[model samples]
Target: MKRVIRILISYALALVLVIVSMNCSFVNIKADEQVYLSVSKSNSWESEGKYYAQFNLTITNNSSKNLQDWTINISKSGGEISQSWCCFVSDLGNSYELKPESYNKEIKAGENISNVGLIMSFPAETSNINASISPVFETEVKESPNIKEEDSNKEETKSQESVEVTEEINAGDEVETEEIDENLANAALVASRCFLSYADAPVIAIRACYDYMIVLNTEPKEEQETIAEAAVTAAQTASEFATDGDVESINTANNANDDNNAYEVSKDNEPVIEDSNPEAVEDNEPVTSVAGNKNIPTGRLRVSGTKLVDASGNVVQLRGVSSHGLSWFPEYVNESAMASLKADFGINVFRIAMYPREYAGYLTGGDKETLKAKIDEGVRAAANQGLYVIIDWHVLNYNPNEIKDEAISFFNEMSMKYAGYDNVIYEICNEPVGADWASQIKPYAESVIATIRANDPNALVIVGTNTWSQDVDAVVGNEIDDANVCYSLHFYAATHKDNIQNKLRYAINNGVPVFVSECSICDASGNGGIDYASANSWLELLNSLDVSYIAWSLCNKAETSALINSSCSKTSGWSEEDYSDAGKWFMQAIKNQ
Candidate 1:
């Protein structure tokens, strides 16, 4: 009788605690009130008696709870939408309802989702097209006596089970660490939420958690790896979700998070110009050493009607690889390595990437003279190997105009230094993120081009487009006046799909000179799995169009984008086995071309 009374008392207490927990869960009922929505419209383009307008929608969640499966009501005065991204639209009589796609369905608390836009086509006669957006928050249900008895019973059982598990864990019963540490699988997701919540969360913090997840993935025990794989997938998905299509944030996070620290420096295979005969490479030769040799190729490169042409108006496609930053990978620029590539692969061009914003970069406390010397060496090496070289001003973190004066000074000096060399090309900007084509990038490019033209008038100059050089279509009608300039288009095959390919096609068809300044077989983050199919398709398109393309990059860093294997530290003369997976694919692609 005493045992039964005690059991009943315990059951009563558990039921009371369960009721309290259920009541607490209702705190999120007013979450919809904390969310805000705004819409802005811009005229994207005018074509064929139709005006295309983009309605960019932004949703900001201020609540502590995440918002998912959300709906927004958009009322438009005129025009019909041709296409939309990041959301699905449904017509409901006079208005439209928008729902997020599965990938971006959840908007974490305190985070805002931008770049959710739709293009609407309006007849040229229609001058005023307007749209308004409002979130369709879930209806609030009041607490009533008519509650479902079964639901209450289920909640009670769940709460009771949770309590039992906690008690068991506290009692020190043998429990699988995986079961107890299930939250580890969700660490990335939680961290992503936290990142969205805090305005000052360091990027390295997120990278540390992601790196730990990678370590979990490589665990020797299968049981331990189950959660690790989940964490990795969650990290990738969370990374995608957190950025909400912002290219700058994605690139910054990616650049900071790549597995660069995992690289091994091989003492035996140091980056040196080794040769059977030491006299093959002469020291400190200028570009004029082979200036008059017709066999080594002569004449300045010019842009002629969507094609890079020689002085004789013959179309030429420059296929080559770009170095990883010169400050970090200077040893890869030796003459023997370039000569070996020219002999084996028939590569015609080489790009020297000089980062200006990263650690040890030119603009950030690095030895400017030392970097300039490295660039000079690389240019000389490429010129000696009968290869055209590109001096890349790799701008990533800031808009081109943000550092316009510095760019002008840098380009002025470089162009004057290599003015007489036909083999030297200038990439004014590597990847201009978060800059407008008509205002920011174009103006800055014009300034730099003007400076370069003062010295090398006919030199082939490449300019980056908006959205980290992925939005080539943005440069179609609003092109720079200089005929020698080519707009840059960069892509990572695994992340970019037909939409990006369509941008390239549109740019080419519209006579916007397109040059793929940087591309790879991995994701945009530069450290994910390879997409051979997409890469092959992209190469086929480039080949058909005779568009110049460059692979990124030349280094032994343990990332998917690195052309060389991390284990093999040789800077040049890479055999089949010395290539990473993406490296091998890129090498074969270049060879096939």
Candidate 2:
């Protein structure tokens, strides 16, 4: 076994050297030869006189013991990084120091870590890259103690059985891991990391990998996961956890490979009652609020031939602010804040952004009840203030289809809870990144829509488009065949100029119902300098088309897109001085409407 291990290590080293020599990249291992860092150009392209490339780095733990607290250094010559994932990089003038995130800080013996890389651009003439691992400790390789052949065979048999158990789990078969060796935990962690390399793989495989990482507590650097047994347990049960749903229709939609029609809803399944309090309002009766004024009038809203219309058939253009992630800013989700926005800011819509994968997100270990309570409070507050509320399933780092079952369960419950409320609009997906409209996203949306329609048949539904909801034109001809559905179009005035505006125009011109669910006057990152000129242009276009629009956020965080000044701690009843620059501008825009 030791001889085989040495041979494999030698082969890996030779392969790294070949890649280095061919690509002009570099590799450096610790002096003790326990760890190795190899850098190679995984991809490259040329645009005009500039060269663009992605460098993939692999770290191998060659020692017979676990390696930790290490760093990789890269001496980059004449290239500017455009994007990077899986490692925290520090700029060191001509070089960069990369440190592993918490979940990947330790690599077990003979394990290698991949999916740590970056993309950069440089002048066509310069493309040199040098990489080396730091603090090379000198340690001699130790031989394993010999064991009797009889005992060795028994241990090997146990290890092989454990391996078979994990395979069974991956195949969606339930199995017992009581006799599994604990050491397999580390192997699972390494396995999850390798899974990241399959970017174009099937959604189930990626989701299972994601759940595996989460279960192992090995959130990669990109999002950040942890635990070997828990990781194994996650491996054993992640698919089951992902596919948890009560209704057969939901289970069908959750199955990515199921040929069942995406638009089918099981009417036989009763609406899930989220709350059963004796004092709770009757399920069939709509909650009516007498909180209507000229500035903030509300009623059932419907999509009518490229326009959002009120019950009276008059074209209605909604204008308002969206909350930052509810988990992050629960303090702002109060009735007083809703009243303030309605009375002072002249806004009629409030979007509650519930992230599904961010810190304390709904699907990622967030206190589900707590987040749901906040959503409930926001919905009721908006209704009581005569404001239409958008329940946004904010998907920043994940695709909508990756967690379709969870989404189905959530929207099912929410739609049921707010079934009778006319002011509540279900924004099924806030922003879907790297999702196809015709294939992945459309089907996911149809399934979710079918679920929503089960309870609230006529409630307005907003669906996100591809590429962070900016590709609204993609839905021009391939729109969802459901009534009262609008495609989301998000923008930041500083980043999305006429190109995005043209896309919106194209969608609208092609008779696609469009809703600007989230937007800001700053850059797309929700930061950077405010571009009021571009914001005004956007408002002008939206107003002319009578398109409803909502600002990116209403939080007081010290950022470009925050509506309130960071210094103001007060959650409601803000004076003119309490508004951020973007906030003040948005306030005036709502008043103008």
In terms of TM-score, the best-performing candidate is 2
Q: Looking at candidate 1, what is the lDDT of residue 303? A: 87
Q: Residues 248-277, candidate 2, lDDT per residue (tens digit)?
A: 111111111111111111112224332122
Clash pairs for candidate 2? 216-226, 216-227, 217-225, 217-226, 218-225, 218-226, 219-224, 219-225
- Write down the TM-score of every candidate: 0.55, 0.59
lDDT of each: 0.62, 0.64
Where is model 1 poorest over a 10-residue stretch in terms of lDDT? Answer: 17-26
Assess the local accuracy of residue 469 in candidate 1 as a C-alpha lDDT between 0 and 100.
87
Candidate 1 displacement at residue 400 in angstroms: 1.0
Off by over 4 Å in 1: 1-298
In model 1, how large is the Cα lDDT of residue 6?
37
